[model samples]
Target: TKSQKIRAELLFKQFEDIKHVYYYSLELGKIFSTNYDKDVARAKLALWYNKIEEYGYDTFTTVANSIENHYERILNFFVNRSTNAAAEAFNAKIKAFRASFRGVVDMRFFLFRLAKVYA
Candidate 1:
């Protein structure tokens, strides 16, 4: 329940860009099947929404908007994750050379090499 509680807290704090909140209600044929308890789920969802609503924050509900997205979309979402990760790894290896004691290479020289790694 820690994760659920954390999620709930984040849900309230991060009421920004997330769209679409689904809450099911378990009722005797009011919304869903007579056997399924749809109203109960919906009640829980409403409770969550109410908690966040008190903060005067608002959001929208969105569904699957893309039909045939591809790997290029994933790259677009994280445009620089790959390059940045590589640069960080390379920087870690060269960090020792950055010490004032080492002074083996000029700071600008080291940075030039690092920049080339990313470029």
Candidate 2:
């Protein structure tokens, strides 16, 4: 696995454009891992956004725009470092259940089954 990872990194190095994008992504991940004060975190996020913009990758640009649109709400994470993981997981489970059954034909029955299984 270590060798495989090295090979992957080498492959990534072959593409100059991709290397910049990957490095920016890694920096973003580093920012998220540390517990900085709100102002510091906001500053770091702004810097990250600027770097992403400089790279001019279409995908990263879309992500940066979304972050800018929700700038204030995104900064709220620094206040308590909380997330909506539980709610997201529940939504995923409901989606999987619906997919497994192809569709929910009866609303009442579906609600009952969901209560029994997930509630």
Candidate 3:
């Protein structure tokens, strides 16, 4: 672990760009992890985006563009701090059920069985 840490430190020292990206990503993660109000979150994200734009890293530029594109959807997280986990879990269950049978033969019957089991 110490060796790994030393290696990481050496790499970061050698590559300033990598260090900037890594720290910036961590700062971005911290913004989402905090329980800020929607307005505050918007302001923080805007500030972060501006900083990233000024830095002008290609990776962060692409990420900033995506964040701009999905700004409203991203902000929806602050409304209730919810995610699509339940829907995703249900989808995973369905996929597992289908896999257990190797494949679906009768589409109608498969739906009936899925409803019976899941409902």
Query: Residue 118 lDDT in model 2?
Result: 78
RMSD for each of the candidates: 14.8, 3.1, 2.7
Model 3, span 66-106: residue lDDT tens: 99999999998988888888999999999999999999999
Worst 10 residues of 1 by lDDT: 60-69
Count of clashing residue pairs in every prediction: 13, 0, 0
Which whole-number lDDT from 0 to 100 does residue 21 have in model 2?
A: 80
How big is the positional error of residue 102 in model 3, measured in Å on the Cα after superposition?
A: 8.0
lDDT, each prediction? 0.43, 0.89, 0.96
What shift in Å separates residue 21 of candidate 3 from its native position after superposition? 0.5
Stretches of candidate 2 exceeding 4 Å from the true structure: 1-14
> If ranked by TM-score, best first, what sequence of candidates would result?
3, 2, 1
Candidate 1's TM-score reads 0.23
Ranking by lDDT: 3, 2, 1
Candidate 2 per-residue lDDT over residues 1-119, each given as its tens digit: 99988987897879877778878888888887899888999999999998888878998999899999999988888889987788899999999998989998998999999999975
TM-score of 2: 0.75
- Per-prediction TM-score to the true structure, in the order listed: 0.23, 0.75, 0.78
Higher-ranked by lDDT: 1 or 2: 2
Best by TM-score: 3
